[model samples]
Target chain A: MDHNWDFASVLANKTLLLIGLKNTLVLGSVCLALGLFFGLFVGAARFSGKSWLYYPATAFVELFRNTPVLVQIMWFFFAFPIIAPFKIDAFTAATLGLTLNTVAFSSEIYRAGLQSIHKGQWEAGKALGMSYWQQMRRVVLPQAVRRMLPAFMNRAVELFKMTSLASVIAYGELMYQAKVVSTISFNPIEMYTSVALIFFLVLFPATILVRRFEARDTFRR
Target chain B: MTEVLRIEGLHKSFAELEVLKGIDLSVNKGETVVLLGASGSGKSTLLRCVNFMEIPTSGRIHLEGKAIGSARNGRVAYAERELTQLRSRVGMVFQHFNLFPHMTALENVMEGPRTVLKCDSSECRRRGEKYLDKVGLGWKADAYPSQLSGGQQQRIAIARALAMEPEIMLFDEATSALDPELVGEVLETMKELAEEGMTMLIVTHELGFAYTVADKVLFLSEGSILEQGTPAEVLTYPRQDATKNFLRGHNMFRLPEPQID
Candidate 1:
């Protein structure tokens, strides 16, 4: 069957798509910021020589990394309400699920950056009488940050794409809104086509930004 | 005068191999002691043990008559906090010049003062600039380690160590990694330091620099000091077989003519 496409139906409901698109971007960015913040601590603790800090951090990273995001989202959406001290809506559950997943991957990236530093750097810090944490904060981590930037940008893109999985929990993000539009319009192909267009519009510039940041730090690296 | 540094029965072993035997040495105040040896002769190992960098298997090290790593119930005991303070007093320069790549030359010099000493920025920066100029790197203070040449980096490393105002400086083949031409500039700075009465222990193969600068010369062989004396006594005279052989290898075994009245 030769199909004649109509985007006007999707455009007529542009407000719904735009709102869902905002939800997607906001959730992705919030998750990213929190994930990166928590991930650095997890990564640093994972690299800690002390057993007490290392084991718990390892468990956190492994539990999130090994499970599928869909399973996690469902678990949070259903189970977290019962387990948590207070009731949480699907929006909070989805945000938490996305953040948990991103933290696990990002923590590993941070660990990779930490280990990329040379052993002599630590010794140099010691020779200068800088304490252990001072070495990390002042010497090793500064160099590691440069090494991890490309990996971090990659994670941002990955998390943005993964936000689509929030649809499973009936979260009002881009994918969930698209399903609503398609069901009502009864034109799955056209509605989904516009959804794809909106996603591309948001992510393309983001990818370009990552590339520019990488190029700027090329000589420094 | 009391010795500024003393090592007694210092022994270091890695697995089955003993890298440094029961070594004994002493460095008096304002003296520059030079260590000469072939590769694997333990000159570097002996120097490292001074600041407990290598953690000698068994030894007693004293700085100005104060024993490092206090003995507790016949066992050597060290508190890490105290050790860090002690190490800062003993500055070191490496052959590869391990400068912090992200920091400028001035920043590298100021790091010790700022972080360890907790000096204010104004004091640290002023002292850093003074040391940079001391090393003839005043114009290059803002340059990163990668931006500088090998010799310049090594000098910056020296200036970094000097900023700590260490009581004794250890140079582990400081000029070995420099270009032949660049070597002179670093050696000149070190010579000036020695002349200014900075007690130093140097492990190097630069015979000319050693001949010109050593207050005492020690020849190490097979993890032990084989010969040691004034440079005139050790370098220009026939001594042990190991010392003679090492000098002969460098084609420098000729002793001065005997004086006749």
Candidate 2:
């Protein structure tokens, strides 16, 4: 097998790759912020004893968690536009799918974190004359958030990787740009390798940070 | 003497099991009432009812002559806001000394004033320091609950309750979870509080503490008060055989007088 590695073509398309990288960051961060913000409420609903809140939250979580992420994105892109009240662009479709997916996964983390706190903490708050929201915000969340950090960092890493799946819908993210460059350059090996290297360079630091948090948590325990 | 707390026909039931059949009690201002009974007795339940921590199945509780919950059908209905207000006035110290582990001792003491009373931070801090000093824990204010001993943590919990300036304090076996050697310090703090004329309702197995500090004593059997009188009358000479048996089991038929410095 005679093969020669050529990096010139891939290096020449740095501008396009940079654009792809920018789009990936934008999508990843937006989804992360929205997902985490909404995830807290959903998690609280699921943790609530009220059937009215618990049932709907449970249904939403199960619907997203049980299905595949690729399928969710595709449904939003290909199937949703027919019934959607507004125009569903590639970015819109991808954002909706990934954000909801992250919400569903991260909500369970929040629920477990909230549940890990002893019931006595709530009783203590109540015994001090704190209202329900006051107890949750002051006493419960401060403690629970510390335990939930590593899990949330892991979710962020997973979410960044999930952004690559938007290529299936031609969203022009990193993976999608790699496909276009490879097809035109006729160098699948070089283009795909660069994409893989890009992802690794970005995510490795976050993975290390998560590991550090988990270590500290274990030691504290 | 003015009544600080009063309970009329307080009944509590958990599903099919009834904890308190019917209870009628009153605590005057600056009075210390001690409750003594076996494990299955309804002493803890009665304390919880005063703060609306355990909603009565059917009964009424009055704090300073004001009824707590509204009557709905045969049971009492509580509003969350009202319960929160009631708890602020009636502080409780639990067996486990449930201090917020994340907060420092001073912060734990300050939390009630800051959040519930909406006091300024400086004012809260001032009150926090005062109560911590009252409990003889002024030097340990910066320490967390985990760093403190069981007795020290219980003292901080007492400070936390006291910072709210409650009208009455309820102790549900407050010293039960402390180590035997550590129990002295906590009991000593409680004795100081009693000497200061704070209204208190205590549930404990320490007959010595009751003998020395209690203004009145009540012995509970099953779910009703079997005997009620002065400590000398109830602890030393009980008319009820059940109270006598419980006292004998504790080996406290004749409690030695507690030494106070």
Candidate 3:
């Protein structure tokens, strides 16, 4: 057994690691913001159904939630260009896949949040002369957001971890860069450890944020 | 004086569970009518129907001499926009004191004037403060609803309704949520409103308050008005056995004993 561990090689490619870090952050942020937007839309559409809006949104959510994320990534990267011909790059394909996945999960979280608000809320809004949209915008969303923060933050961390799947599409994010460094330096353990550390650097703070937000509204939960 | 609100042959049901059964009711300009009823007696539903919150199955409602309910393709309909306007005209206070939890007492009062009435910010602010003062919450304008007690929140709700300058106000068991000790403060505010001749319909169990403040008291049972008369007549000398039984069942009335010579 040859025990020759080289930590220097892993640290030496700081530049490549930094590029990978930047890509991870960019993808994570975009996925978080857009994921929430589409997730809220899907959740609201599911809840406020006129049948026309409900079935299609319900199908979209079920399709994304039921399938594996890896399959979704592969489809968006390889098969989507053939079918839709959008000609999306690896980064765009990964972002799209991650967005759809996050939204489906987040939509369920949001539906739970929206349903928890008491019926008295709607009656009170009506009594105040609030239009249906005004009640949702002014009253329901504000209350639901407070209830949804912890779940949203948890899903955000999950989304961050899921970014590793983007590596399958050659997205050049942290995991892909780690694999390239390992292949070149022939030091799989150290290279992968460095990548895991990078993930910890990003994910630990998100977990803390969720804890803090939950602490602030302990009564609500 | 004109009739501010009129309900004729109003019927409402929920999947054959009839809530309001062919009820006829009216209120003249500036009249304060209090409805007394047991739980599940349709008093709340009737109030909701008057504001068009629950569309009547079949009925005619007139507000300020204009029909509030209309027929569309042989089916009665209330347009969403019309319902919004009708609700604005008739503000309501709920049993649980459903104040917007995020807003301060002042902001709760300001929402209607700013959003529905389109009052300018300056006017809205001024009127909101004034109404808060009217409801005895001027000192608590900046306090959030959750920070306030149930009674205080109920008072803010009343002030919020008053901010709309509604031609009529509806109260659906407004004081029921308050701690028994705190109920007096909210009842005091309503009494003040009644004394000022604000056109109002109240659904309440506070027998003493109805006897004191109501121009007329309506007693409801099952899905219809069991009886209606001046407070002294209905609460004291009831003609209907159903109304008498209801009052006795709630332990809300006691007949005077015969004198022995």
Candidate 4:
């Protein structure tokens, strides 16, 4: 059987893909921001030395990181409605699932970064008369952020790819729109290729930006 | 002269080893004291205990006659914050020259005054510049630690410590990390400070420099003070066998002629 490439069919779904692309951007941006906030809390708490603060945060990170994201999306979509009386939409569920996953991974990244800092840094801060909080904020966090640069970016890339799984929750993002167009037009190659291109467009610059940041930091050193 | 620093019944241990066994040291105001010791003699550990950088196993340390950084007579007199506040009065310069890598030389000097002392920006900057110049690093104000020589970095570290305007300063092998050719510059800077009446306790192997600048020279061996006296007395007329042995072993003191056999 000869394969006929349908350029027009792919082009016709541009509007759908544009809307999907917009949704994907919104989802990734929100998840990244909220994930960082939650992740910082989790990461800082894990090292806070208080058992009560660390243990529950550790459990949350482990539960999210160990399980599959598809199951998490399903739990949020199908199971959360059962446990809670509030009716939630697919996008909300997808956003929540993605945010939780990002938090788990980012917290681990932060913990490793924080641990890599020389104990001397803390001592130097303390010796300079900095309070414990000041030591962590002014001295520890800046050094840790620099040390975690590569890992932080890699996690963002991972989160970007993971957004593809949001399709399972019927979030109407890029992957879901790609599936709909390919099924209707029967042009899997063209539609999927276009989908891959859209992803590259969204993720490629972020990777470059993160790399630039790493480069600038290294150069500073 | 009144005492600026006094340590009594100071002891420190790690696991099975006792590093400092009841070290009692005192430095009068405006006096320069040099601690001489071989490797693993616990001179550095003694300095750490002075600033509460390493919590002593048990001890009493007084700074300017005030019970600070450690306890006295069974009561916990200083909390962590108060101990930190006390540390601001006693600056320390390390052998490795622990300047923050991200900060400029001037910024490193300014950090203590700005962050700890809460000095206004103009005053901090002015004092930073003066100290940097005093240490002969006036031109390297904007350079990072990586850009400076080992000696230059140590000088910057000294400047950073001095910017705190501390009443007492501790030098833990300050010039030990520098090139032999570069060591003289830092020692000269420190000697000048000593002449200016800066109370200092220096742990060093530079016996000649120690002899020239220190009012009192202390020889530590096996985690205890083996000998201490004026430099002429300690270097020229050592009374202890251990001091004589250490000097001879390190080629610091000339050995007597061996009988021809």
Per-model DockQ against the true two-chain complex:
0.52, 0.56, 0.54, 0.58
Candidate 3, A1-221: lDDT as tens digits: 57677789988998998899889989989998999989988998888756998899899999999999989999998999998846889988899999999989898888889988887887777877889988888878888888899999999999989999999989999899888988998888988888898899879988999999988953322
Better of 3 and 4 by DockQ: 4
Q: What is the TM-score of each candidate against the true structure?
A: 0.90, 0.96, 0.94, 0.92
Clashes of 1: 0
- Candidate 4, position B239, lDDT: 92
- Tell me the tens digit of each residue's lDDT in model 1 across A26-134: 9999999999999988998888767998999999999999999989999999988887899888789988999988889999999889988988788788877777888
Superior by lDDT: candidate 1 or candidate 2:
2
| Chain B TM-score (each prediction, in order) | 0.94, 0.96, 0.94, 0.93
* Candidate 4 lDDT, A1-221, residue by residue in tens: 58876778889889998988888878888888889889988988887779998999899999999999888988999999888889989888988898999898898888888888788777776777788888787777877888887787878787778788889878888898889888998888998889898789878998998888777754165
Regions of model 3 farther than 4 Å from truth: A1-5, A86-88, A218-221, B72-74, B252-261
| lDDT for each candidate structure | 0.89, 0.93, 0.88, 0.87
Q: Looking only at chain A, give the TM-score of model 1 against the true structure.
A: 0.93
Q: Best-fitting candidate, measured by DockQ?
A: 4
lDDT of candidate 2 over A1-221, digit per residue (tens) = 46688989999998999999999999999999999989998999989878999999999999999999999999999999999888999999999999999999989999999999999899999999999999999999999998999999999999999999999999989999989998999988989999999999999999999999888843132
TM-score of chain B of 3: 0.94
lDDT of candidate 2 at residue B257, scale 0 to 100: 82
Top model number, lDDT: 2
Q: State in Å the error of residue B114, model 4.
A: 1.2
Model 2 spans with C-alpha error above 4 angstroms: A217-221, B72-75, B252-261
Q: Between candidates 3 and 4, which one is better according to lDDT?
A: 3
Of all true interface contacts, what fraction is found in model 4? 0.40
Question: Which of the two, 1 or 2, has more DockQ?
Answer: 2
Worst 10 residues of 3 chain A by lDDT: A212-221
